[model samples]
Target: MALYEFRCRECGSTFEVDRPMQRSSDPADCPDGHSDTVKLLSTVGLGGRARTATRPVRPPSPFSGGGPPPMGGGGGGCCGGGGCG
Candidate 1:
């Protein structure tokens, strides 16, 4: 079952109705004996528990060499052949 809200154009009254989802689009009679009613848009409220999966831990790769090399390892710079003089 679902709850739907409706507004009566004749009396300018708003009300809620509890009925099956199949009859949601059916015409609704106002409580004040008004027949000119329009179904009002309503927000849906949901409650439940969400689950998350745990990721597996991975070991370090052999190609990484544990960490980066020490600074000033002597390599070609922008001037090439380390000739920055």
Candidate 2:
């Protein structure tokens, strides 16, 4: 059974009805005996227990190694500083 929300055009009142999914489109009468009620589009509630079929894998970010590279030139030691002979 599915819970459906409906609004009465005659009394401008809103109410909910629990019925079978096959009869979801069937006309529903308001609590005040008014026959002018229209079903409303409701958001589905999963009660915070929704699960997915598979987990999505996120692409690796280019800046994952911290920030940008070094500022000026100057390599790391060795022949960069003319220390090799």
Candidate 3:
């Protein structure tokens, strides 16, 4: 069984239901006893994660060292003498 989302037109309330895929598109009555009900868009569940073919890759960060390189003079301390190295 799959979980589906629904919206009640008469009560303007949204709810979820668990049902088979075949009945996923069927109109369901509001639990509040209203006749005006409509099926909302469905979203893929956690089970869909197993269907992914490849893992997404992320780019490397440029400042992994936490500070910029030293200036021209090797002995010269960084800008404000703040030990960024």
Candidate 4:
């Protein structure tokens, strides 16, 4: 089964559908019974790969002596002192 998101053009309501993968492209009705709906582009997480944007994994630093890991920044501001880390 696959999940899809749809937005109603008539009433402007967004909803989700959990149906079979083959019938995922079928038209969907809104909760208020509106037919003029369009499927939305949804973001899918494949449950793999490490995220290097917000939380990147790195090896423990040798200077901290088993304390918190070193922060990654240009030594400028909040993220520099590891406050926002």
Q: Which ten residues in a row have the lowest lDDT in candidate 3?
A: 73-82
Per-residue lDDT tens digits for candidate 1, residues 56-84, read 76764534444333356534344423457
RMSD per model, one decimal? 13.0, 8.7, 8.6, 11.4
TM-score sort, best first: 2, 4, 1, 3
**Separate clash counts for every candidate:** 0, 0, 0, 0
Model 2 stretches with alpha carbons more than 4 Å out: 45-65, 70-85
Which digits, one per residue and each the tens of the lDDT, describe model 4 over residues 10-59? 99989999999899789999999999999988767345666677876686
| Residue lDDT tens for model 2, 26-65 | 9999999999999998867436656798989775443453
Which is the winner by lDDT between candidate 3 and candidate 4? 4
> Against the unseen true structure, what C-alpha lDDT does each candidate score?
0.76, 0.78, 0.70, 0.76
Top TM-score prediction, candidate number: 2
Question: Model 1: runs farther than 4 Å from truth?
Answer: 46-85
| Segments of candidate 3 deviating more than 4 angstroms | 44-85
lDDT of 3 by residue, 28-81 (tens): 888998878887765567345445578786653333433444465233243434
For this target, which candidate reaches the highest lDDT against the unseen true structure? Answer: 2
Question: For every model shown, what is its TM-score relative to the native structure?
Answer: 0.52, 0.57, 0.50, 0.53
Residue pairs that clash (backbone atoms under 3 angstroms), model 4: none
